[model samples]
Target: MPPDALELLSEKGSAERALTAALASFQEQVQAVPSLDLAAVVEAAKPAFSSGIAFSAQLVDVRGRHKLRVIVMHAGGAEVTSEEWADEVDDLLQAAGWMLAMLLGIPLAKQARPVEAEIAEAECLAVVGVPDASAGPEPSKKEDAAPVVDLDVALEPLTPQEIEATHQRILALPQASRQALTKAFREHFQVPRNARSIGDRITQHQHAAFIDHFLEECEEQSLDGAAAPAEP
Candidate 1:
């Protein structure tokens, strides 16, 4: 075999090994979060590589809520340096693990603080080139913030049948549970108790979270044997 051909084969082998190790590390880190669905991670976490960069994607589920996260890592630098690329890959994987934990509503493990610091350092490096190692962190610029608006104004109204079904489901719950859910719904939408139809209060976009929270509360009550008395 030609020397050039052997060199190319060796580079390819090294890239594969690096990618495999990075993926294993990612899996271990993610699985440490108790709330993350391991089955979903196994099914959705696939790694792809192109042009000396690695990409990974996964759909993580927490308490029946699903979130998809994609991570990209560039292993190669301006020069052909394997060490630089490997370090970059490790940094990205650690950041991705922290991101997934946050998305799933899991608190970050204490050891993961460095990942956040590293991400902040990277962002600073991008904006200011080499940062002064001795200087304290610079104050971030404050920009005018946009006023938040109600989401219901933008959401499409649910159909009559959907509204009716939702009303029926709410009514089927015990009186105390129903009242609690109704109070939550009113507070969430800032709707007057008697001002809007059930359907109007719960738009299509808000329906899933509304119902899921309600069901979770109901389950908790049931497990505790504290279900409210059903209304006649």
Candidate 2:
């Protein structure tokens, strides 16, 4: 978890009592973590920016008392299997929310009351990684002046490296599946007449998701005892 990466955070629960109410206080952004549409997946190559957090919880009986146990999932997968417990429901939720934020690489400035978990003093105070004072000079104000920026943030456009990587992954498919994927790409987009047209078509689409879906379909077809041809 890179401390400042917050793409999308969603909460769904197994128990709907105090647990559901607690999760409701949390928030969500962008798409669902486990399942997302094409629009939501745009520029999602970086795992930090694309990961999702899901919190599943259940009530457990310890001896004769009940406790709330929260299980957290990152990017649709459970990162840790250890149990985190809370005696009271609200206290449990606050701690869970704090943990969720921490997993996204952030710590809350106003942490909740003292729990059995060690409370670090730094967590209550702001922890600055790079002070603004350390940043070089501020841009001079002039009509035509612009801040110096070495890289364009319009990174939504696919880079050559990403395109080449996708192309290689697509080409790694079974020859028949690879050919079918190329054909699908052509049907979706017009390809120019050239020796490298197949590769070019794949590059233009810049859609690794399509290939992943194709591979999934292949797996399903294999399980069904028949080879399935990928559809565009």
Candidate 3:
């Protein structure tokens, strides 16, 4: 395909053709179930099957630059061979992923498709021209320009000691109490701002969850230990 045609297909302009063409290849295998809406079926299958999409998805590059993203959501097995028609398969999967996002009402911008990308090194740098101390019109004697300041900040990784201390604190807490804390943390700290860097947040939350679970287990054990006074 021409690069422009490929680019058009990648964008939303020719999405339907790209989508249908990609999905058509699977017609023989998935089989047209009577009265079954194919798009709806995929939507229903999403929660269970979407994670696999990433494994099958790839950013296809030509030379050092990205050309397209390819993903194959449904396959017979890990050994399904595509040696002969890999390009077709890649195109099909990419289109299908796009279609799935569309059918499920996911915004095009938020479609769960991998991106093939390329960036020029020169374009990546900041361009700052040297200041000319004498070129500008003279500053008014009555007015003062705002002060210019550059703020430099550094981010530090969590120290091992801090991690250990957090872990130990979680371990000391009852599981039930830990669960409560995790829930509170998730509700109070993580969800409000929609934080993207949730790994550390989850680690902290999980400590609370463990404590909650531990407490629940202890409570159950205590109940069990308490004699059922002459159960009727």
Estimate candidate 3's alpha-carbon lDDT, on a 0 to 1 scale: 0.33
lDDT rank order:
1, 2, 3
Please name the candidate that would achieve the greatest TM-score relative to the true structure: 1
Better of 1 and 2 by lDDT: 1
| Model 1 pairs whose backbones collide | 75-85
Q: Where does candidate 3 have its weakest 10-residue lDDT segment?
A: 116-125
lDDT for each residue of candidate 2 in 95-196, tens digit (9 for 90 to 100)? 443333322222122223333211222221111111235335742222122222234432244544454455445433433344455555555445543222
- Model 1: weakest 10-residue lDDT segment is 77-86
Model 3 residue 120 distance off true place after TM-score fit, in angstroms: 61
Q: Estimate each model's TM-score.
A: 0.28, 0.26, 0.20
lDDT of 1 by residue, 93-116 (tens): 443433332222122222333343
- Per-residue error for 201 in candidate 1, Å, reads 1.8
- Residue 86 displacement in candidate 1 (angstroms): 63
lDDT of 3 by residue, 61-100 (tens): 6665543332333232221111112343334443444333
**Deviation in Å, model 1, residue 98 alpha carbon:** 46
- What are the runs in model 1 whose C-alpha is more than 4 Å off? 1-156, 193-199, 224-232
Point out the higher-scoring one by TM-score: 1 or 2: 1
